[model samples]
Target: MSQTVFCRKYQQELEALPFPPLPGEKGQEIQRTVSKQAWEEWQAQQTRLINEKHLNLLDPQTREYLMEQMERFFDNRETDQAEGYVPPSR
Candidate 1:
């Protein structure tokens, strides 16, 4: 069975990631606190931000900006959105 974590984003028990998404303390922290569903949503948002903003990942500032956005996202705080992007109607 998959491990479950008290998701920091969803604020309830949910399926946890099988492994750390990054190296070091932050990855471990996320593995312990963030749900897999939340991580997947963040990845989709990150892709949209990168594509819409034409962000260059090679730039350190761009990486930092994305990281800040990720934190805000997980914390349920106000975060930047890709301009002119619309979600599909369900």
Candidate 2:
């Protein structure tokens, strides 16, 4: 059976991740608060940010930027977007 958590992003109980997505306190907080679905969504967005912005994750600055974006993402705060990105029409 899958675990469930009170997802801070979704504002309700939902399926939980088996482990934290990152290391240290932020990862622990995500484990306790973020849902699996939300994390997956962030992964997709992160990928877009990487590809569109040509972010080199190997660089410390890029990694730090992504970390901050990840925090804002889970907290439902406004996050930076890839330059020239256009949302697909529904």
Candidate 3:
């Protein structure tokens, strides 16, 4: 039941799976599963940093800016999901 043992047992099986992994987990998830402790620690640190540092800079305008940039990136996934195009991309 320990993580390392599980990884050694199932890593190939997981990697050879036919379907795509979840979106955020597309590539790194196998390693993440294999290295659960490191992954959790890294995620915790990243969450702490993002929540404490970058998130503090956010405001209504900051939200708008993020919406703008994300909409523009990769051909406007945001606007399509928005039920309509939105904010006119700035």
Model 3: per-residue Cα lDDT over 1-90, one tens digit each: 332423332233223323322355633453444334333433454344345445543478654654353323323133212222233455
lDDT by residue (1-90, candidate 1, tens digit) is 998999999999999999999899999999999999999999999999999999999999999999999999999998899998888899
Task: Using lDDT, rank the candidates from best to worst.
Answer: 1, 2, 3
Ranking by TM-score: 1, 2, 3
Cα deviation of 87, candidate 2, in Å: 3.6
lDDT of all predictions: 0.96, 0.92, 0.38
| TM-score, predicted candidate 2 vs. hidden true structure | 0.87
What's model 3's TM-score? Answer: 0.30
Provide the global lDDT of candidate 1 against the true structure.
0.96
Off by over 4 Å in 2: 88-90
Cα lDDT, model 2, residue 28? 89
Candidate 1's C-alpha runs over 4 A off are none
After superposing candidate 3 on the true structure, give the runs of residues whose Cα lies further than 4 Å from its correct spot: 2-34, 56-90
Q: Considering every candidate listed, which one attains the maximal lDDT?
A: 1
